[model samples]
Target: MTTRNVRFVGGPLDGRVQDLRDHEAVAGRLLKHIHLHDGPKIETQYELHYTPENGWVYFLCGTQP
Candidate 1:
C-alpha cells in the first residue's frame, strides 16, 4: 500500500505524486517535471524545497523574474 498520496503544486509538477513505492521513480519524475522543461536542457536547474503541510506534499520556490 502507498505510504501516502503526495500532492504536487506551485511548479511544473502540479499534480499528485505517483509511484510512491519507488524512490527512483519519484526522483526521476520530480527531476523531469520540477525543472519546468520537458525537453533535455542542461540549464534547467533550480532549488527545490520540500514543505509538506495540511495533508499536502507540495513545494514553494521563486519564480523566474
Candidate 2:
C-alpha cells in the first residue's frame, strides 16, 4: 500500500497542497464543512490522483458556477 498527497488548484485554495495518511477522512470533513457553509447545491469537485509509490493524490474542490 502507498500514501497520497493532496493538492488544490484554480480556486480559492489554489496552490495549496497537503500530505496526509487519511486524506479521505480529511476530504469528507471538508465536504461536510462546505455543505454547511455553501449548502448542498454548491458546485465543486474533489479530484483524486493515484500513485503506486506515494499513494492517492487529490485536488480539493473549488467552488464554481
Candidate 3:
C-alpha cells in the first residue's frame, strides 16, 4: 500500500474555520467514493489540519501496513 498527502492552498480554506469543515466534508465524500469502488477492505489513515500562518489546507492519507 502507498501513502500520500495532498495540500491545497488559497483555494477555499484560507484562514477560515468553516472552510476547514467544508474541506473535511469534501474529504469524506472522496473516501466514500473510493470505498464504493474498492470495496470495504481498504484502510485509511490520515489527518486534516488548517493553519492560518501558512494559509493552506493539508491532507495526510496513508494505508495500513
Candidate 4:
C-alpha cells in the first residue's frame, strides 16, 4: 500500500465576496473570457474543487491546449 499527501499554496479569498454563488459566477466569467481569448476548445478537462478549510476553490489538474 502507498499513501500520498498534497498541500495547496494559496488560501481562500476572504473579503466582500464570500458567497459560493459569487465565486462560481466569477469563475464562470473568467473561464468564458479565457476561452474567448485563448480558443473555443480545451484539450484537457479541468477540475475545480472547493473546500471550507482551504477557502473558496482551486484547480485539481489542467493542461495547455
Candidate 5:
C-alpha cells in the first residue's frame, strides 16, 4: 500500500515526520505514542488535524496513566 509522510507537531514528537498508510493519513486520526524516558509506563496521545499552513498537526491529547 502506498504511504504518505505525516508531520507531527507539539509534544515530544514535534518536528518528526513519519510515513503512514494513505488511508490512515486522514485528519482527526488519533495516535497513541508511548515514551520511555527514565522508565516505562509513560504514554501520550496525539490527534491529527489538518491545516493549510502546517498540514497535518498532531496536538497533545494529554498523558495517560
Candidate 6:
C-alpha cells in the first residue's frame, strides 16, 4: 500500500502529521479523528476533509460526551 505524508490544519489536530493512504486520499473525503482531552476529559470530533492543496482541513462536527 502506498501512503502520502499529509498535514492536518485547524482545531486540536492542527500541525499534526499523518499518513494518508492512496485509497483514502480523495478530495472531500471525510476522516474521523478523536481527540481525548487529558485535563477536562472531553472528546472532540474533527471531521477532516481532504483537499489537493491543503491536505487535510479540520471541520468541527461537534463534541462527544
| All candidates in order of lDDT, best leading | 5, 6, 2, 1, 3, 4
lDDT of 1: 0.42
Tens-digit per-residue lDDT, 1-65, candidate 5: 98767777677888899887778867888899988778777788999887788766678888888
* Residue-wise C-alpha lDDT for candidate 2, range 8-50, written one tens digit per residue: 5444455667765653634233431133355445555566655
Model 6: CA > 4 A from native: 39-65
Per-residue lDDT of 30-64 in model 4, one digit per residue for the tens? 22112334546533333335455654343424434
The true-versus-predicted C-alpha distance at residue 34 of model 5, in Å, is 1.0
Judging by lDDT, tell me the better candidate of 4 and 6.
6
Worst lDDT run of 10 residues, candidate 6, spans 28-37
Candidate 5 deviant stretches above 4 angstroms: none
Candidate 1: Cα lDDT at 57: 51
After superposing candidate 1 on the true structure, give the runs of residues whose Cα lies further than 4 Å from its correct spot. Answer: 19-53, 63-65
Model 6 error, position 16 (Å): 0.7
Candidate 5's displacement at residue 25, Å, is 1.7
Put down candidate 3 lDDT per residue, 1-65, tens digits, no spaces: 33333353232222333233433433333321123245555444434543555433444355542
Q: Which pairs of residues collide in candidate 4?
A: none
Specify the highest-TM-score model's number.
Answer: 5
Superposed model 2: Cα runs more than 4 Å off: 1-4, 22-43, 51-56, 60-65
Residue 10 CA error for candidate 2 (Å)? 2.1
Quote the positional error of residue 47 for candidate 6 in Å: 5.3
Scored by lDDT, model 2 comes in at: 0.51
- Cα misplacement distance, residue 8 of candidate 5 (Å): 1.4
Error of 3 at 54 (Å): 5.8
The 10 consecutive residues of candidate 1 with the worst lDDT sum are: 41-50
TM-score for candidate 4, please give it: 0.28
TM-score of each: 0.37, 0.37, 0.30, 0.28, 0.75, 0.57
